[model samples]
Target: MTESFAAARLPVRLTINPRQRQPPSVDLLAWIHRQPEYRPVVRQAGGGGGRPGFSDAVIIAVLAQGLLPGLFNLLQSWVDQQRTEASIRIQTGDTEVELQVSGRTDSARLLAQATEALRAAREPGPDTARELGAGAAREPGADAVD
Candidate 1:
């Protein structure tokens, strides 16, 4: 199953929220479109709870399964460059894997933890529920939300 699975095959949605008092002047959607690597993957801006245009949160379209890995990598790079405190949420079906990242975040750890969280999310077992339940906690780089 893992062999046949492609990043494009896993449907994904990414929401990026900056954890700062003052919103940055940068336009995430526009920034993404400028990147040749990310332009195709970015579907649109997400409104989240409020009007799509009004909210600071920029939500992209649901990702193709095969695109998950690449997008995540791109996001990691983006985080490193921006060095902003932010929350990244990946949602699919009923599972939502969230990461609270800042300039101080450990990139290697963030990737590892996000991968683990995703794995657990995909394969829920007796222990899986506890690992992925609401209020799930983690070290500095990433955070999981049930």
Candidate 2:
């Protein structure tokens, strides 16, 4: 018998607006796909039945590996060079978070916050049920406040 299980998918949405006259190009798409953990699907503005001038382009990607600080740093640098206003939204299951990068925003700090958020999501918390059970076993009213 074979059992089917749903695979985890991490969706990352990137919106880029170029400062220059040129919109995002095929080379940029290729560069993103070259990254180890990224599988990118690029869509030009208004090309996928969307409104015109919404953005220069959008890249929706699935992250095959866990979040890495270096990846964010590299993206930040690229956006900085292009003078692009960029926003990245990461969604895993029901949790969604976004980061916006502009000329004045500090990328390192943004990366740190993202790392913390990811860590908190993935790490299990204390077992309150187990703790309560242990206390009850030791004394019937151990946890009761008098």
The lDDT for every candidate, in the order shown, is 0.58, 0.47
Off by over 4 Å in 1: 4-8, 23-25, 43-55, 65-70, 124-137, 140-146
90 in model 2: Cα distance from truth in Å? Answer: 0.8
| TM-score of decoy 1 | 0.65
lDDT of 1 by residue, 22-138 (tens): 455565566555667667768656455633333456556566655555555555555556655666776766667777666655555555555566656767566565356323435
Candidate 2 lDDT over 24-116, as tens digits, reads: 443445555556555434433354432354454555554422343445555666666666656565554443455555555465666555544
Best by lDDT: 1
- Which window of 10 residues has the lowest lDDT sum in candidate 1? 137-146
